[model samples]
Target: MEAVNLNKKECKFVVAVDESEESMYALSWCLGNLISQNTTNNLVLLYVKPPPPVYSSFHAAGYVFSSDVIRALEKYGSDLVKSVMGRAEAICGKFSSNIHVERIVGSGDAKDVICHIVDKIKADTLVMGSHGYGFFKRALLGSVSDHCAKHVKCPVVIVKHPEKR
Candidate 1:
């Protein structure tokens, strides 16, 4: 085992995941590649929470939401996100943690929110799985990985699972 820098903080990296095999595989791949044997670089695992029905807030100032309303939306949405995080942790534990993990859930388009978060955290690398779920599901998810790969300024890595035999 290589000596780890106990004092240095590593550059942040973002991995957008969902409750899917592709997402999990992608994260695991990133852990092995982007991370060193031991580093403090923040590895943010983000799952985009679906927006609430009554939680519509436009960018314009025309919409005003009460604090209580915001709280309720967050309260419910955050709970869901945390639940997903728990599952993510279980998967993460199976691998060695060369980087620190921080789970986040944002409500919006997965690609947009992911990009925003990447910028917000100044991510050194962004990793994701190829969007094609075989052939059928691929049409629906479109290709979040494809979108992010094109948009993000940071280095983007798309982890592709082995082709079916």
Candidate 2:
């Protein structure tokens, strides 16, 4: 085994969170286990909003309420991002208020956006929650954590909820 340093150092950790309970659990786990009060830790909370739906002026059902509906959809997405970040910040506050926390909202596929942001930020480690999908379901739907583990240069930690296990 390689020798590891336990001394305090500035470390940046990117945590990918969503509306799922699993993600929140993962965030909590990270705060409890990995973070230390003595160390300079940068906790980045990343939320990726799904790509907006492509809609024309007329819907498939021949409805012409595109602008109003699109605006509403956009507003909802923005609100959801704020809500998720708020929850995450609340969790962080419960953990340690001294730790530096950064919130990032990205719009795209979760896996791709996560990988890109991790690289862009030069994160020391990436933490995320596993959906706990079985083999067949994971194979069919593809796992974001799995893809990120394979693609990102940083070490990836996929936290499986206790209930999932």
Candidate 3:
């Protein structure tokens, strides 16, 4: 295992977050377990947005999709980013205020974008949540954390939420 740079004042730690409860669990776990509540560190929260909607040629035949529709979609995407980031910030605030949180929004496939950002930022670690999907479901839907773990050069931690009663 590679030794972490404990001497660095602000080692960057990236956490992939979304609206899912699993992601929220991962964020909370990272704050409480991996990071010190009293020390200041660079905490990056990453969110990947889906690619913009592509309009088909068929739509131009009868009537064009108004720019309003596109704007609305963009607005919804922005709102989603804000909502998820807000929740993450709240979690951090509850745990500790010493962490300096940075929000990063990327566009593209989740797996690819996450790997790219982790490399680009030279982050110390990448933390993500596991959906805990069964084999068949994972095989069908694919697992973002699985793909990221293989591609990211830094250490990847996949946090699994405890089962509810």
Candidate 4:
């Protein structure tokens, strides 16, 4: 395991964006620390979208889809997007246009995609939230932040929990 000695602000940074509060908090931390009062650096906020569920058979289509379910899903997704956008806006609000801020939506394993982007973009630093999930669950389920910290070659910054943050 690597030690916590990241100095990401000196180089281009990539921060993963999810609907989770942990990731958001970590993003906030990156914005506050990495984005300087007068400097240009790229801050990419990535949001990973889950692959929509696919119905197994067209025969079930005749049974009529629940409008509520559809509405619920739409609302859920929209809310999620808005939340991330809001966090980004708050972080870069004070920065000049030179500070590149972007929102990317993708569907895939967050870890693989993040590592790929980090490599392709040549990002030197990565920042993310802890998701507050326990270490055991993180080891078993594989947290997004954890995956990035493990796979991405660049330095990673993980926003700790509220108390620690």
Which one wins on TM-score? 2
lDDT of residue 100 for candidate 1? 70
In model 1, where do residues sit more than 4 Å from their true spots? 1-9, 54-80, 132-141, 163-165
Cα-based lDDT for every prediction: 0.71, 0.81, 0.79, 0.67
Query: Between the candidate structures 3 and 4, which one is better when assessed by TM-score?
Result: 3
Score residue 153 of candidate 4 by CA lDDT: 86
Q: List model 4 lDDT by residue over 87-165, tens digit each.
A: 7767677654467777776655557777888888888688877763321233246777777788888788878758665
Ranking by TM-score: 2, 3, 4, 1
For model 3, the local distance difference test gives: 0.79
User: TM per model?
Assistant: 0.69, 0.83, 0.81, 0.69
Error of 2 at 141 (Å): 3.9
Q: Residue 156 in candidate 4 has what lDDT?
A: 85
Q: Over the stretch 45-90, how does candidate 1's per-residue lDDT look in tens digits? A: 9887654534665424467777777788768666756666787777
Please rank every candidate by lDDT, starting with the best. 2, 3, 1, 4
Compose the digit string of candidate 2's lDDT tens values, residues 35-74. 8777799999998876554334666677676588878867
Q: Which segments of candidate 3 are over 4 A away from where they belong?
A: 1-6, 37-39, 54-65, 132-141
Q: In model 4, where do residues sit more than 4 Å from their true spots?
A: 1-11, 54-68, 71-75, 94-98, 132-140
